[model samples]
Target chain A: MTHLVVVGASLAGLRAVEAVRRDGFDGEVTLVGAEEHLPYDRPPLSKEYLAAEECPDPRYREEETFAGDLDVALLLGTPASALDTAGRTIAVGDRTLSWDGLVIATGAHARTLPGTEHLEGVHTVRTLDDAVALRAALRGGARRLTVVGAGFIGSEVGAVGRKLGLEVTILEALETPLARAVGERMGRALTHLHRRHGTEVRTGVAVEEVLSSDGRVTGVRLGDGTEVDTDVLVVGIGASPATDWLDGSGLTIDDGVVADETLAAADGVYVAGDVARWPNALFSDVAGGTMRLEHWTSAADQGGRAARHAVDPAAAKPYETVPYFWSDWYDGRVQFVGIAPEGADEQIEVVAGDDAQGGPFTAIYRAGDRIVGALAVDMPAEVMKYRRLIGGRKTWADALELAEQRRVQRAQKQAAKERGEGA
Target chain B: MRINVDWDRCTGMGMCESLAPDVFEVDDDGSLILHTEEISADQEGEVREAVAACPTEALSLDGPIDA
Candidate 1:
């Protein structure tokens, strides 16, 4: 049997094993992970799990499921110390494991500020344990929570903090919350959402140091020589791909493990998940060469795709899925599909509903006459419709008409359901 | 037969509900709420289109179907 050695037993790694099995590959599959725990979902760690919402049973999967259903050899708590690509073996601590095929789904690590590690109240949410620890700190009803970096994780945690009735203040070095991804317009809209939810969102501010006394967090010092007293400090600056183990692995490691369009790195080796920055058809031109995403769901999709390709390279196609992401702040659900270029040079056409209350609205991003991307706020149906329109390369007029038609159809269906046509 | 949406994967872009209204619906917070567990034979084509149209690949058919 061909031995498939998959490093990094994350969501992506676990899913890859399943995909390999589903692809009819009756082979020996070994899944290695640095963390001792079984593969669990990470997105909920910051949102639902922190809110103490049952933590979602079977966070990812039980070990028994992997053993019985997938027939995967789970090597928990063992880190891949190094990769000998030429030799086609991975050095996991004292043992050397050979492989007919290899998959690098190491994923990314939470970036933290220096000197904040020893601080008691300073926390970063990445793994299940991180969420458990943060939840424990939040349950204590900390007087205030200072969040560094107003990115998605920070903002989401801040939203949870406000919901938990904790005094929350977010320090963002950028002028807007998501200025890098969504331009100032959308970023400002998110900023408004944060402010509306009673979060003290401070933009263009930097945290100089996390002040701690007796190994406990006292407060944080701002770059402007001001001190903000807080019991807890959450750092959400960003994440770096965990590719240090591949230093001499001969695999290309840029921001992540660089793979071809098919997600293959070299012979008998593949990359997937957040750790693999592969060429994406959607953002290839805009992102220079390749795009690296840390999305939980995308990683799973990529894992499945990579596994299929690794099992049978002749049957694989290039990884070209539409880019999609979402943010849940307060009661508002902000979802975006496709890449809206910087200074997209487009007008916002077809505002579906009222925007005053932040209800359902679809902002069509156009470059001249072409619809490049769609931003939907509280309008999943329209967003779903537009996703097809965008993927099909539908004309702007057709997309607009489709959006309108779907809206009317939804209303009619709801009316019929209420009248007992369909329960 | 049915569309299973991994909510974690769902960006709430709402593509599935739009293409196949007979199948999918959105909650108050814009998260996808499946209306029916199994799609009628008539709505399969639309549901399949909706699944393919999903940008995030969040929507997938429950059972065997021609993709």
Candidate 2:
């Protein structure tokens, strides 16, 4: 391959370009991004960036240094319009670029409510621009913040709003926040974490209509006719994979651009990041093989893997990973690794600290005899151990053993600390 | 080669520890403990992986160590 084209100068796209150089591909590399800014970290947008008095610099590398070091041609502020698989060409803005190999990392766009698109004071935290605007609104003397969605983004925004001393309220359509993903019991336990910090979490409610005045949002009307008064509204309803440009491109499009076990959408065309949906053999038994992750870690891993495979197809290996993601809310940290297999009989057990007291805890999700997932809140080290176990497809009994070991070690450490303090 | 960590960007996520257990560790209170700053030839691959895997982009590799 003489020339390589990476679509979506995102986290995945940047990594793909880096991997190409690392794999000794001394060819022309072009990275196209919709935004003008260089590749920056997105996780901080909702956390520190929003909470801080000044926005923190989140760029992975400087634009000039990155381009000079990688010898890449960056097409920033230019979004790819379409793809031509047969001709191996992509439409970026007014120009058409041909490639010997392509990595599609278009990623996803934040989903907004239907009627609220034109309303002011409504924000979504998917991109840096979105976060910046939202942070400005928060710091611009906005009194009340109403978040429409109890998912990670919504919860984090609510937490940050509360930290800024705003009256924050989180609305969830489901009876329990994250009930489907983390089970009802654990979901309530997590939602309670924000409540401890003075964020009102209203469950089993949907936004019936967004009330506005003078082209600006004032509040939202609930499904039950109750209205909330607010100065700003945030719609964290989630996101859809940015695959609209790939229409009729001949690649199978399901929830995302469906790829094979090798992450190849077609010959010489590989897909990565949130836009690529492929069969992860790691969770084949649990999720029926098909999986797509929107996490930062997976994007980095799959970006490099897809690039390496595109450069050298013969040495390519199937991309199997123990999916991992972490979220920061209030004074606690939430992390989850591995797939919580969807089924009626799936079990959730708290093997670590007590969950009822609203403190630190680790819960393992089981599918029959095998441990499929683990969720850790404020237990970082123990979570990594469970991630290893989940990747190995270990059993419930094995997880229990590990939990017991952790308990014994914790007790020993506590006793030693007490002895030292006594002396 | 030497590994340089941007302490301001590091949140003690322990991703480096997970990728290269021998090179890094996260204490109980979520403080990062770097065992070694210099990277050996044998451990370069995993250390590079750890740097790339870091979500915050806080870890970076400098040029080769001086003689």
**Top-TM-score structure, candidate number:** 2
lDDT value, candidate 1, whole model:
0.78
Q: lDDT by residue for model 2 over A10-66, one digit each (tens)?
A: 899989999888767898999899999899889889887898876667887788866
User: Candidate 1 — which residues are off by over 4 angstroms?
Assistant: A283-288, A345-350, A353-360, A403-423, B1-67
Candidate 1 lDDT tens digits, A132-161: 899999888697998998999999899899
- What is every candidate's C-alpha DockQ against the true complex, given to 2 decimals? 0.30, 0.42
Q: What is the lDDT of residue A307 in candidate 1?
A: 81
Candidate 1 has a TM-score of: 0.87
Q: What is the lDDT of residue B65 in candidate 1?
A: 56
How does each model score on lDDT? 0.78, 0.87
Give me the TM-scores for chain A across all models, comma-separated.
Answer: 0.92, 0.98
- The TM-score that candidate 2 achieves is 0.96
